[model samples]
Target chain A: MTKFANILVPVDFGAPSRRGLELAVDLARRNGARLTLLHVFDVPVSYAGMGLSPTELLAPMWDAEQEELDRVLAKVRDEIPEVSRETARGVPWREILAFIEQRRPDLVVMGTHGRHGVPRALLGSVAEKIVRLSPCPVLTVRAEDEA
Target chain B: MKRILAAVDLTSTAHLIIRHAVELARSMGGRVRLLHSVVIAPQVPPPGVFVPLTSFRAHELADAARTAMESLEESIPRELRDGVVVEIGHAADCVCEAARAYDADVVVIGAHDYGLISRALGTTAARIVNRMDRPVFVVRPMPTSHVVEPEPVSAKAG
Candidate 1:
């Protein structure tokens, strides 16, 4: 049988990421696989310079992001049989690569991020980096252009 | 997800790519169209004010690719085999064009061992993703040493 037992989706609550999640949910349903929604968490730069306990300073942010993740997951809970959520704290691309290495999902479904002062569509961004470095299949879902 | 366009390079990974395509087609109740692009190398005239005729035999390459594609097709279940297409031009362009012509819902492509150039610019798969409106599945090209040859389609059901 074709085994897509685990599929990972990195969400940023963006339109493209939502497109990716929708595709992933459908894929998981067809393949009878589970989905993992991973979101990279970053502490605001304001709290970084101070040598305080970063955990305490970032708790609220973490909680807030967790809630956001929950909200995202709730939308697809009924569609996927075993969908899970996670939050990683680091650079988005690096954290995603680390998660893939640690969890070794069969596929990664993510959306392409838009222009960020760099070359248009070239990204130099998370989706591009993950597409270049990811060890498994990566299905990139780009949002349809508005007419 | 009914129509899957699989772009394959005629390397060892071609077999693995076909396996992925077949498996996906089986699962999603889809039909797969295998596409191979015969990348034509650009020709330059002789230097020192000498202009000469030049030609790149893309047709021969396409024929060879077709033979190879047929070999790979043997491994695919007959039902899932939609067809095979051989195009002459840039790989990414051919893939997108074929996808559009076939009206494929998703495109499956293999990511290969790219050099420093692809790292700086972009891989073919990435370019396709940037341009194509639909989903593109980029299968990681496993290192040759670590790769295990795919078995027959009949035995792959396990």
Candidate 2:
């Protein structure tokens, strides 16, 4: 039998990720699967010599990022009406995979830009990376195709 | 009508792609072909005096594929069953070759998230999409609850 007990959607507070979220929510609502909305707080980094205290430099960023995530979750709840949301701290890809392994989610819905070249190489696409390592099935909604 | 090919492998996710293709075919009114490629058994080494010779077999593997299709038969809505097609070969090549031979309009597949290694090596769906000349829809299997079972739009007359 087909099985999907939980669906994990990683959000970046962007249109692409938002689109993926909407799709996941509608799907979970229809299928009666619990939807977990996640936003990761990437660890802070500061240059060595031109230093400020770690907390002084990083605390504000963490607060601001958390605030933004809270707003995003609120907005998703308002629009979709049914889903669970939480925030976490770590590298996006690693955290996403950890959640998958811990939760053993049946599916992961992600969005991609289908990037190529130097910019893609530098930033490293999360969706692409997640697709590569996720043990479960991943649905990558392309931004260009959505339009 | 242009043929639409849905490639099925032994993976659990393959059914999701098949269902998606059936839905698309119902909407587009096209012929659908379901192809499952059974890999020919690998060659066995020659027998040593102390050991029995090994024989490679293909039929047993093909039977497994057929059984899987049969188990999933009822899950496929009735309207789409008439066009179901099943064959076996190495996953990537068979999917591409069948698409070509059938002159399919679109090819649908389901991809498991294989992580970093598969990305570098390219997953089967990615390989097929890149190497083949057809649009490939790689759907992530929706959680069973999320899988929308299309309600019949028209009611039967009494």
Candidate 3:
């Protein structure tokens, strides 16, 4: 039997990311795989100012974000309770690759909006970059495919 | 007799695909053939020199291909050994052609699940899926060894 250890999934609190998380949960449950839920914080410039005290500026965002994570975990626990979470503050792509490098998950499952036409062409795609760069195999689930 | 064909690239993904194919072949009482294809790029002349180009050794590539197939065969359960077959060629074309030649009911493959463009136009898996006559089961690269629970028979049904 092939064992999948350390399954890492990057989420953005969006519907597509949620779908990816759901699938990852199911796979982890079935395989007894250790699951890591990752959320990358792509901080805007306003947050970068040194003037604002950590609590004065970042408190609300942290509270809201943690609340969302709680909601997401709640849903997953409703179905399967075994899951772990991690949060990283950096670019989505770099942080994801760095996390993979540090932890070395067997698989990285991510969700793509699967945008088309102007949106897809102009923005390129994070999923595409991850596929080309990641050492471990990646599963890029389309938003609609999960439904 | 039902036949199963597994494509390998000598990557970890190959291990996943071969294992899945072996199980499927075992359940169906079918023979399994493991095929690998090496995409050899044509040699190009150096910028200023026009030297005679060296040809690639088809046999050499085929030998490496056989080795990859054997690697997969070694990982599979012993009962399925007699039915295993290995060959190498242009991955996309070889996979589709081998299936036709062997009359394979299904070809097991692994794809790095990406967007529609990536799925449809990027990888050899997409190209093989498009060209092959037989159904190609695309296995997600998630390793299943961690699942402590018994695999539901239905998990492998597809």
Q: Number of the top candidate by TM-score?
A: 1
Taking the tens digit of each residue's C-alpha lDDT, what string does model 2 give over B32-132? Answer: 57778777645655676443322224566677777776665545565555354555566788887887888776677766533443434245666564455
True-vs-predicted CA distance for residue A1, candidate 2, Å:
11
Per-prediction TM-score to the true structure, in the order listed: 0.84, 0.58, 0.54
The reply for model 2, stretches above 4 Å from the true place, is A44-50, A115-124, A145-147, B1-6, B10-75, B79-122, B128-158
lDDT of 2 by residue, A1-147 (tens): 224457789988777777677767755665556778888877645434556775887789778877887777777676555677767787888899788878777668775554333322311267766765666666555454432
Rank candidates by lDDT, best first: 1, 3, 2
Q: In candidate 2, what fraction of native interface contacts survive?
A: 0.09
- Per-residue lDDT of model 1, residues B1-158, tens digit only: 49988999888767677777887787789988899999877667567666433223678788899998877777777778888899988998999899999998889888765343343324676677667767788876665563444556756432
lDDT for A139 (candidate 3):
54
Tens digits of per-residue lDDT for model 3 on A29-102? Answer: 76667788888776667667677787777777877887887777777766666677888877788888789868
Q: After superposition, how far is residue A85 of candidate 1 from its true place, in Å?
A: 1.5
Residue A104, candidate 2: how far off, in angstroms? 1.2
Question: Which is the better candidate, 2 or 3, if ranked by lDDT?
Answer: 3
**DockQ class, candidate 1:** medium
lDDT of every predicted structure (CA atoms): 0.79, 0.63, 0.64
lDDT of 1 by residue, A1-147 (tens): 346888999998878888888888988999989899999986577777898887787887788888989987888898886999988888889999899979989889988754433444564278888888877778887765410
